[model samples]
Target: MTGIPKTYQRIVLAARPRGPVAPENFRLETLDVPELADGEVLIRNHYLSLDPYMRGRMSSAKSYASSQPLDQTMIGGTAGQVVASRNDYYRVGEFVGGMLGWADMGVSDGVLLRKLDTTRIPLSTYLGVVGMPGMAAWYGFNQILEAGAGDTVVVSAAAGAVGSVVGQLARLRGCRVVGIAGGPEKCEYVVKQLGFHACVDYKAGNLEADLAAATPDGVDAIFENVGGACLDASLARTNAFARVALCGLIAGFNGQEMPIKNSRLLLLNRVTLRGFIITEHMEFWQQGLQELAVLVANHQIKYRETVAEGLAAAPQAFMGLLQGHNFGKQLVKLI
Candidate 1:
């Protein structure tokens, strides 16, 4: 065994919640790190992204992949600086992206972790805009939704990590952007800050009307985020042959299972709905990243992160995200 001291610190999935995940679902545990094999590097985790999909992973049932087995370390996508390396590909000063889960430190084979240029983009960007969230926007808007200039594009969760980028990119493409967020401040940010043409607040108790007022010509494309009432309302207003990209359903994350309604209406509306995973669009990553970097560098786009200071506070931060309490991207700064 390579002489790397063993240590353990993990958020174990103690139990699956009956509804939205609860604090008890995770228990902090400490264990020894396995010795680093050749071609492996150890990272001292810096920032861990808290995404909506983590909600599904917490459930003990199958969704996209294997469920987080009970009593095991929870899974997450994290960015960290390399502290030790046995692989020439990853030096001690290099930053990396990997399945590091939620811990202060972790070891992985060079295959699972990719070196990142921290000088070009902040390490945090690897977990958001220049990373998975950016990837989600590239595929959802360009490939899945196929958004076009002058087309009316509506995106729910518009002020979030993914939706925010989608809205700005569609606007950059000369599309009319309409965004749906939870409250008035977020709505204002979407319209005034992100340059979206219109925005609505689903929490206003009149989402349907506000939504209608935002898209008088009807929506040509929609990037769905909160998928209960918002999805239903968007479907009702879709333009002929409109397209929809199903990204996430935070509405159902808390056990509010909304039945897919108006299934027959797709035949009438000629709407095309596609569900996508960001990993599927690995090919288009560079094209999107190059553009996104320019936007960020030029201040054409902005991002907000509701950062939680310690790894121990991650569960609370994650819960806030699922509950719409977070103002923007949710993250845990372990370093």
Candidate 2:
């Protein structure tokens, strides 16, 4: 803590977006690092996670969670090292993960912080693969979908943090996995790199036909990330009693309407669709993180990230993510 800076830069939610998010929605502020009280810890964040779910947080519309208040630090997950501490449980230099918002430094009372062990996995991954995204994938796939051997599992936004893990886990369970992504490059990575049996490029303008071709046996389970046309196409090809883990609806994040044209299939096919918010299910996180950590450490799982440099870049990076420009988990390197 000897060379710690007296002040730090942080990005706050300057304004709420009306439609698609813009750079004007965020504002950077420089503030003095506060003096720690009896049981507080200071963290120097290394990475900031920019996720699709964050878009919902930026709106005033009613949802499962409260909207991010304006003129405050933009809400986000952070991975960092404890630079200073007056807390007995957390010592200086320990790696940690927390909801530290979009800032290079944050202070906590240790209640919301989780000490991390980077020995088996990288610290940055704690914000992606083995963190909230990984837990969401695990809970949704294992608990809801319950996909097993001989099943045909389809993952939309397969190149992203959550969907990527879902596809790989399904593959590990001896299921035939098909990925739906935005481009030929992402599709190739899903099959060639992530080991999915097939990948359908939704941007190819043949979503329905291509998805049908990919899942000739009919989709047994779907980890849906992008809703609209991708979900409609998959729903049209579902087998009877298929399960759908409705995750993010990123296609409609910008106020665009995303209606499922084949919604009638939900009744005809007797599909079981469940939408979940991972934060509501905290009890399963430890169990899920342990499994994900081992898989990541042993190279049994693969992940990719598109990182923007510094706090000021988070807004642009996040906007790009919503527009489907990012290839994988979008993040900001704060340090």
Q: What's the lDDT for all of these models?
A: 0.85, 0.93
Per-model TM against the reference: 0.95, 0.99
**Native-vs-model 1 lDDT?**
0.85
lDDT of candidate 1 over 181-218, digit per residue (tens)? 98999999888888999888988899888889988998
lDDT over C-alpha atoms for residue 309 of model 1:
93
Q: Estimate, for each residue in 1-335, the C-alpha lDDT of model 2 and write its tens digit.
A: 68899999999999899888988989999999999999999999999999998999999999999999999999999999999999999999999999999998999999999999988788889999999999999999999999999999999999998989999999999999999998899999999999999999988899899888888899899999999998898999999999999988988998899977898999999999999999999999989999999999999999998989988889999999888888667889988
Give the Cα error of residue 335 in candidate 2, in Å.
1.7
Model 2: lDDT to the true structure: 0.93
Clashing pairs for model 1 are: 7-33, 8-30, 8-31
Residue pair clashes in candidate 2: none
User: On a 0 to 1 TM-score scale, where does candidate 1 land against the true structure?
Assistant: 0.95
CA lDDT of 305 in candidate 2? 87
CA RMSD (A), model 2: 0.8
